[model samples]
Target: MKVDPDFLDTLRLGGEFNARQCINCGTCTALCPLGMEIMPRKLFRYALLGNKEAVLKSTEPIYSCLLCKMCEANCPGGVHIAENVRALRSYLNAEVLEV
Candidate 1:
């Protein structure tokens, strides 16, 4: 997938979540009871690298997130996981749905 290069910077403008803090430790995914299967870690990496298309295509996992903070509580990297999910939803609504 082609990287937009500016996607991450643009997402940061929302100031709701900080994906950069994530260390890709997989702690969040392991703790997820909802069986997220794909999420904040992989998605964050895509976001960090500005892979807009990859991130966008992950709508199922993104929207499937319960945002229960289950992952956030155990996150060793201190990533605001719920906030990141919310940010992704917001981005999709604004940029994809044009709401």
Candidate 2:
């Protein structure tokens, strides 16, 4: 997908921050209780690729997040998944207000 440059920048800020350190071991996904339904790893991939449509369209799953921080706790890279999710939620909320 052709993601907008501005949106891509946001993704980089959130996704690239610790992406190089990620091992893609699936620990985060495994540790995430929500992974029973939603996949944080997939969300991370979409964020890394700057797929804004996918990310934003998946906002419902994002909102379903318990923000338990379990994923962050288990992340070997210390990627702060909860914070990224919160940031994305904030961005989406602001966008909705502007619409």
Show the colliding residue pairs in model 1: none
- In terms of lDDT, model 1 sits at 0.84
Instruction: Give lDDT for model 2.
Output: 0.70
Residue-level lDDT of model 2, residues 1-99, one tens digit each, is: 866657746644433333545667888778877664445777767767777778777877888889898878888887877777776776677665342
Which ten contiguous residues of candidate 2 have the minimum total lDDT? 11-20
Candidate RMSDs in Å, in order, are: 1.3, 3.1
| Cα TM-score per model | 0.90, 0.77
Each prediction's whole-model lDDT (CA) = 0.84, 0.70
Candidate with maximal lDDT? 1
